[model samples]
Target: MPTETSSLELVGVLDELTPEKEKYSDALKAAGEGFVEAYNIFQDADFVTKKGWKSELSKDDATVHSKNLSFGHVFALRTTLPVPIDIAFRESFLNFDDLATWSENITFSKTIAKLTDHVDVVHYANPDVAVVQSREFLVARIWRKVDDDIYVSARSVKLEHVPTAKGRTRGHLHLGCARFSPDPTDANKTTIDYLLSIDLKGLIPKAIVNLTMAKIILKDFTETKKHYANVLASENAQTHELEHHGV
Candidate 1:
């Protein structure tokens, strides 16, 4: 598994939106949709051609070459829970295979097919490394490394439901590991040292195409974060009141 580390220290009310285990389970579905949308943008012929990514694929066999490309993207999302929240609840969602599937009619590419064929899903839940599922599958496992360690893996699929308040939702998928570091000072305000690396095999050298796709994924997450933040704010206020009253 490929790994990179970065620190992210969330501030303001954001710091209190600690994720429960169930939240990760819910987010997995949303993350999957984000991943798919991002992949489509990356694979668009016009977008690829305009950005010079087409050159990476064999001109004589664009489909074959494109099909063999190893490009993959992963996303790690973290939210801080209030002090009173149970960590066990948060860890429950670490088992990757528990994610909900948004659709049964989804199609995958050859490259994705190959990776899933060898994919494994394991979580550090206890004495046993729970193997939720294995074999070639579109979405890999969800994992929570030992005590704030970096979690790395790749996945492809959308499982989480998007909030209705966000308006009509778009399909987006996330295929990457979740890295968590106990330290602060990471680039993305992540408490757990984390890195969402995207393998730019066929898309490398096509800087424009790669960047455009990256922007789409980042933007989607940015908006998603806004929605999460809004929800968190309300929750935090309620919790604070309960705490003040010793509830």
Candidate 2:
């Protein structure tokens, strides 16, 4: 019998080849797709999501590669929870107000003075580490009234790279998007597609980076779901009580 291989070992096999974009050809390598060759090697490999949530991650091969390595990861997770789409959208994606409450690492967060609606620049500080105010994010967020679905696409941004904060590691997330859609068959079911594409353009090994990403996401998968479920249930009970009293 074949030894049960881990995802990291499979990814290590992929780390051997180097991208030779200079000698690019459609057969050897494509022009527009960044790091396509790297991600393409694991196209068939099986991956486990946070809490076994059945997320599928695939590369979006069309967009031009911005970083040295070019690729985009497309991930989708579908669940039939006993909650309406609007509630799901609010609790899952639009819960910025409750973000610090739900996430254990987030010490502080603030919305930047914006020039327009639906675009938010959020600054995040992680106090667990010795350094203060460690991370920041630039996001474009929306809640569509027509479909009652919520969508957000975000990318990480850095102000002045703090060299003194050696304890803090520089992480890279090239692209990310989230989509919350309602299930057509049932009014109470919903599906969330959280997609990302990361090719860390640094000295760190891709396998290690991959491992870290998986762990952080896995932590969120269980915690976020439970938090939302409880909050929604409480709100629902209040709504029912008010309706019964004719309020």
Candidate 3:
């Protein structure tokens, strides 16, 4: 049973949270329009601009085409959070075992094998993709913690040999990882860069893939920005409450 005073305090916290949301949205809008290109390395397909999050999309065979083969580079930023670098690195990128804790896109993840202390071979399923009238499959990503960032390299693993209404197919490996480090200007804030160089493989329509390519690519980073904003806002609110109560 909560008291009226506590309820009033909760409402006040929401008030603080709402304004922070607006601030974070503005920051992300600016980031999408600026500082996006600093993450791009691939010359041809790198479409990332400072306009939030971006990805370059293409197919191996455009004509006589199948959605089975497509590859590109993706760049996204998780910014405007005042969390420390180490915490940001762990929660945003390193903590794969509990990925569903922070990432909305990844619904479930469990460790299939532990290669070492820093590396986790994982098998994850995405129900989000299954509902799209698209070919569904299981993904196995290798998570390795580098010096300052975590590297997540994955390929489509075979859930089944033949294609079925519910079966898996072969996939390829894309070499790149998200890097994390301290912000040069602000010690309290952290910057996150997600660089995905993946060749998405499966059976689907090339036209469909091309049509929704930008949305699919941007989905990863869009979630990242939202998660980042919510994380810091919640933290700031807690800090405010503590000070208000003289705790």
Index of the highest-lDDT prediction: 2
Work out the TM-score per prediction: 0.33, 0.56, 0.52
Better of 1 and 3 by lDDT: 3
Report every candidate's CA lDDT.
0.31, 0.42, 0.42
Best by TM-score: 2
Model 3 lDDT tens row, 1-247: 3332211111112111133233222222222222222223312242224333322442221111112213454433333456677666656545666866666565555654433333333454433443243323233333434454333333443333223334543233242344455677877775554443334465556544444433444455556556766777888899999999999
lDDT of 3 at 83: 65
Which ranges in model 2 have alpha carbons more than 4 Å from their true place?
Answer: 1-69, 72-80, 105-107, 125-149, 158-167, 198-203, 243-246
- Candidate 3 runs further than 4 Å off: 1-83, 127-173, 205-207, 210-213, 243-247
Worst 10 residues of 2 by lDDT: 23-32
Deviation of model 3 at 151, angstroms: 5.3
Q: Candidate 3: give its CA RMSD in angstroms.
A: 17.7
